[model samples]
Target: MTDKSEYKDSFRCGYVAVLGRPNVGKSTLMNHILGQKVSITSRKPQTTRHRVLGIYTDDDAQILFVDTPGIHRKEARSINRYMNRAASSSMADVDVLLFVVDGTQWTDDDELVLEKLSHAKGKKVLFVNKVDKLADKEEVLPHIAHITEQCDFDAVFPGSALRGHNLDELTKTLKQWLPEGDLFYPEDYITDRSERFMAAELIREKLMRSLGEEIPYSSTVEIEQFKFNDKGILTISGLILVERSGQKAIIIGKGGQRLKQIGRDARIEMEELFDSKVFLELWVKVKDGWADDERALKSLGYDDYR
Candidate 1:
């Protein structure tokens, strides 16, 4: 941990909330900026269901990047409401609000995020992500122009989060907006989340990637056991909770092949992230209406922001 007094007088440190609708690459942008995988991401919408902090420290500034859940109009379930609350809450008490949008297209969800951001106070930055997907380079300017027309932004940059394009310039510009202050987190700390929470997220990411559209959203991961054994290997046991038995059956697959593959994939990533020998065990359990039940959602670690 780096002490606040140890930093120079000119050092700048503050929170930057990364706000956007689901599947807009908010997590991907934060991960690339920190040069590490602190936030889990997938093609599925609302992959990030919590307000994850990714701390970045450099010689000049320390940026506490708050990677939040994508704000959408759908508040269909308890989990959805929880995610929206988590994201909306992050808007307060941040030094900057980095609004990310898919440059290829825009939707009502983007407008919803912008409307929510309108009430928040901060240095607002518009990030037009996925510009690389655009067939013509000229299309970028018009798209950026259209978005900026709706709301006044302090700064706007068009870049590709996946390819790490224009992010360096964006970071430099963001540093200018932050006031000089002490580091919020230690210099070496990359995230505020615990290793146990990260393990559960990794398992959930595998579930999202492996399963079909509906199951991933209905499922959640709970870390039952996490500890270093006497053999110097980290052993983890995770329970996958779903709303229905049919969803559990689909995840378990024929002879449990699907579950085994998901666990294997998660374990491999855990080994790389934890930098240790990992022994991961996974089990599927049906918890009826867990996603909609407020008590169940809270027990599953969904109410931290609330």
Candidate 2:
């Protein structure tokens, strides 16, 4: 008598890029799909500064969803151009393109996004995210009609990524579109980013949440320490690099209130995500014109990571 183990054949696998205008909830959709925060999101446009790869897998398929930076009509700095390229880079050889749109409005930004998609040659799914916030789903029809008229997408789905509305349908639709192949990532894996990367993003999310409009844009968080303790604690130390001394003062606040607030918010989220007590340490450093500095951007994992 002999015991035998079961073996399965190749499963469905493919890459899908989640692209859209900023604040359209692309990152939120991605976080929902992966069941974790793989990307930082904010109400501000261009929140995502890089192409974040989040892997979702079940018994049948593994979908590598790339949450890219929001596209804007600008050629300002090298990073802006890099972010723009990050959006299109996912299209080169992906099985699907999840083109997300804000359900709140169908203004020129939506049209501009559609125009970008028109040039992409891939199977596309139109996702009108934030449907729960919409007073009338019918209001999205004109925008949908306008986009569908321009490009022949495979399907259109109205969903609330925040509220988890119609997400099962969206997942099911994606499952159907994936091609049969070996799983790109193991079933247990969720994202390709490392612990340090996630910590940096968490810090960035706090900056986006706590800081004023100009502050987040002028600062970048860099992780300098990441270590796990035997007592189930994770310690992360990072520096907030700002573009100016004035920005540093703003981040530190009048009596270090703002910095403390950001640290508290970030540490709380980090603890939850890591499932351990997180000791987050952040410092502010002024590096003038770091945003436009090629070396600085490269070190921050922008063009190099791309």
Candidate 3:
């Protein structure tokens, strides 16, 4: 797959940044494009905190998809500021920008995305996602029409990432705009993120789903230990950080039932993701105001990976 002969003389390759407000299916779109889950998704906003690259290669084209944290106007905490910076930085030095939005609803945040796009000088493409949830199918065209008035985008695509709708058409359009260049990664590689990073994300995904509203925004997961034992079974020790003892009690639940369930579910996902047996352990620790501290964020592995 690494052989240059596998590629054609006119092979196209370029970076495409997937930018939008939070919870607008940006991660879902990238997962569908790559045919695997490189970014975590949940009902909760701000699920993606760092930038991840999903690479797709074929006979004539290779698309390096940049899945960034969602952009918003509010930068209340250091983490929010970091997310905004990550999203904005992804827009620079890209062949094109795929600005995604929820077709079912519109808000000032959508306008905020447009404002960001207004300053970006590269080719812009719009994707109105989640059209399958609309009560009336006819609302899609009107929504696209309204957004077209705001910015003269090079192209507009309306599709549903959830249902795999119109994605083939979307891929065709993206391939046409790429520049002729060598592949940045080998054809067999789907993502640039390490296995440890993905393990932490998978654990966080389970916690977010299990704890639901009781979990505070300050909560984060860090893998303290990850190694294979003599028998070749993976062993993992994770630290679940919270802001207060009360949050810890809530996560622990009565007789530690809740934490056990969270660990059980997370271990199952880890085994599936790694394709090996895993022995997992979890502990809750209080880290007061870690989200607001920039140094703490860096220690928690929130910094950019390149």
Candidate 4:
């Protein structure tokens, strides 16, 4: 029988950063791995604007997964620069760098992501995401081989974040790479971010999904007020910042129907997440060029995670 000391030798705990270009499913992978929605997801690129920490703890390991904004070449806006910096800085001192990419398609943004990964100090693992979309499973080998030649990744894994394929194997490999240490968070804890932060993200996600493609990128969400009553009912007031008066009109829609829909959808999700009744008030305010202004971005909570 194995001794307790021997068992202790197998324990591991450390931070793992999930990185990739926009729309590569980094957030999806983290959310699926943790079995909770700590980060928001959308069909649109750059849906994640901040660095989100998803904590996973078990008997053998505690992996703090850092879900970073997708790195891209777009630094025209201050928010874009902030996101790139957030993703880049998260790789520092991390135990594992899990670089995810789309198996169906690879773009110049992906190459940019790889360039950033090259400079990271952590042990790297290449995740070829969305293999479930492949016409034939055998196509993955050549694709994996092609990426493996680009860098010195410790391991190359192929899986679908949406379908939950090979995630267990990826988790096992990540645990093996972690150093032996005690858990950084309690067993039941799943994220380091506050519920207030999550409420803002959830509202932003609903807005992103509801708005047209042209309007989503020019918007951001901020939680102005969050309070819980004695009856366990949570009240949240959020401000959605847009870059133009035109965008604000679009968000508000005819007779305020669009804004009401956004609030209703976001409130439903918040209730389920907090496990209590929730009242969410959403207001769309135009802050011209806020995404381009570093000071305004900081005020809206874009600079806090850094």
Candidate with best lDDT: 1
Better of 1 and 2 by TM-score: 1
lDDT by residue for model 3 (152-269), tens: 8999988899888988888888998999888889998888888889888888887787776746467999999999989989999999999899999989999999999989988998
Location of the lowest summed lDDT over 10 successive residues in candidate 2: 1-10
**lDDT of prediction 4:** 0.88
List clashing residue pairs in candidate 3: none
Q: Where is model 3 more than 4 Å wrong at Cα?
A: 214-216
Question: What tens-digit string does per-residue lDDT give for candidate 4 at 149-249?
Answer: 88789998889998999999999999999998766777788998999999989988988899888799999888889999898889899999898899999
| Candidate 1 local distance difference test against the native | 0.92
Of the candidates shown, which would achieve the greatest TM-score relative to the real structure? Answer: 1
Q: Estimate the lDDT of model 3.
A: 0.88
Q: What is the lDDT of residue 166 in candidate 4?
A: 92
**Between the candidate structures 2 and 3, which one is better when assessed by lDDT?**
3
Deviation of model 3 at 12, angstroms = 1.5
Query: Over the stretch 1-306, how does candidate 2's per-residue lDDT look in tens digits?
Result: 111111135457788888887789998888887788888888877789888889887766678998888877775877777787778677778888899988857666666677878888778999988878877777787878877889899999988998888888888889778887776665778888888988898888888888778878878889999998898778889999998888999899989999999899999988888889988888999988888887888888877334
Cα displacement (angstroms), candidate 3, residue 247, comes to 0.9
